[model samples]
Target chain A: MDIDQILDSVSPIHKDPKAILKSYIKEVNFPKGHLLLHAQKCEKSIYFIKKGIVRAYSNTAENEVTFWFGKEGDAVISMKSYIANQPSYENIEVLEHSCFYEMNHTELQKLYNEHIEIANWGRKFAENELLKTEERLISRQFRTASERYNELLKNHPHLIKRVQLSHIASYLGITQVSLSRIRAAKN
Target chain B: MDIDQILDSVSPIHKDPKAILKSYIKEVNFPKGHLLLHAQKCEKSIYFIKKGIVRAYSNTAENEVTFWFGKEGDAVISMKSYIANQPSYENIEVLEHSCFYEMNHTELQKLYNEHIEIANWGRKFAENELLKTEERLISRQFRTASERYNELLKNHPHLIKRVQLSHIASYLGITQVSLSRIRAAKN
Candidate 1:
């Protein structure tokens, strides 16, 4: 989709406001496995995925734990790091050759200050993110590993096809072996 | 604390804007154990707790799972229900005799439309909530049950004293027996 369409999908805005927002967004591309943001790095850019997939994960002492994936039309940011202007606890890596519309934190803040509609859009976006996070937390707490896998498959079948099994396993907070077994059982 | 002070703590605003916001806020009280919101109910009021604690939980077939707690100076809302105007998946209950400044969803939307500062405040509030929910999700995925319990104790010692052990266990996604064992082990 074009920038205008993407912006409209996020929140409707008038032509002048859309033009102002468009000025701040710079399109960029990255190859697969490209690290967009690293843990312990302070970066202030939020990316709107025009195409491709990205995975956000945290590295523990023993292993890397996948948190979530962002596909096309999704906004990818280390929210805590971006909001607090602190080092990120999670690393975001592109899993496929990607195109994104990048918005610098300072420019976005300016837009929020200048436009009430943008501020409202930001509120709605954050609320949606919170809701998705809450759903993930609830599933993790209440659903079994197999149940989670089933739900993931049912909800994001495309994701399962595109992403590696190990990454998906980590996202589910289960071992790859367990995931394999679950997959086998399903088959 | 008064409504003005609470609003100030969230994000500072000019006197006139503050007065406009104050007009929409209604102070109300609920006794301990009062069910402020129920699962599958579509209500759209966000409460800013002036005094006392509230718990948000979801009821599964097997048991009720406590998701999180909100104390004095916290905003309590079943956000998904409020945002989508759909039945909530979680229930909110008063754990202590509570006083709150309640703002209806429609009034909040109107305030956002009329006041840029209020919209900015809402954006900031939502961003903070997203940060918190992300933190909770990360901990749940990465931390051990005992580690989670210990973290809960260290961060929210007051919660331990105020709330039931059962609810705390539910929040940790552990049985009461497991929580007891973990507590004993820590001691």
Candidate 2:
């Protein structure tokens, strides 16, 4: 879907708000395995996924920890760097060849200032992102690995097929072997 | 600070925006140990702390997990419940006698629709909350207890004095004994 259609899907914005968004947002594409952002680099833009999947992760000395995955209709941004205006410790990498409507952070802020609907959109977008992060944090604190795996199966079964088991395990804060065991038990 | 001064501190909004916000927001006080919001209930309002501290936590069969703390100038809300419009699984409790500017979620939404600056403020507020949640998630995923403790000391040392050590330990995802050891070693 184009920007107008996507905006309509959420809430119908008038021509002025749509025009402001379209002016600042540009369509972009990336190949599979592309790093949209790298650790220690600042993220200057937000991407609204039109197609494919992207993963956000950080690394330790031993391995990388996958924390977030964005798919079609979702907006992806480095919350720390985007809000705090600092270098990100996480890398945002494409899991599949992806298409996105990309908006520079500065331009988006300008749009927010220029239009009320756009600002409301920005607020809703941030709230949605916050809700996702809070859910993940709560799951990590309270749920076991198997329970988390079950939640993934129940809520986002497509992720199991699209993402690698290793990445899924990392996202669940469990080892690949443990994830395998969970899968085996479920099957 | 009153609503006007608080709004001025962020960015000088005109009287229209300030009046709109003030109309929706009401000052309220809670005695120490009050549950501003209890588990399994919907959070109808967001609180901006004028004074004192608040703790947000969830409980398992075994124990309560303290996840967040809000102090002066902070806005506290249950992101998942507030954004998703569902009953909260966590509890928001007053840690001390507190004063806050509280705004009903529905009224705040109305204000966002009626005013551009208010929408901008809401957007910024959500972004700030998302940043904090992301930081905590990253810290939990990547940092050790001792490292997290050091970060807390460096960033929010006053919390150590104001909050109970047990709650602080829970926030760090460590046991009270481990926190005592860390403190003893530091001393």
Q: Tell me, by lDDT, which candidate is best.
A: 1
lDDT of 2 at A25: 81
lDDT of each: 0.86, 0.83
Fnat across every predicted model, in order: 0.81, 0.84
lDDT (10s digit) by residue, model 2, range A62-174: 99999888878877777767777888877889988889999898787777898899889878877777887887888877788899889988878887888899998998888
Query: What does TM-score give for chain A of every model?
Result: 0.93, 0.91
Clashing pairs in 2: none
Per-residue lDDT for A15-126 in model 1, tens only? 8878888898999999998999889998889888998889999999999999888888888887876677888888899988999999898888888988988887777777
DockQ of each: 0.82, 0.73
Once superposed on the true structure, which residue ranges of model 1 sit more than 4 Å away at CA? none
What is the lDDT for B75 in model 1? 85
RMSD of each: 1.5, 2.8
Model 1, B1-187: lDDT tens digits are 7788888877778898888888888989999989888888887788889999899998888888998888888888877776677788878899989999898988888898888999988877877778888888888999999999889889888989999999999899889999999989866
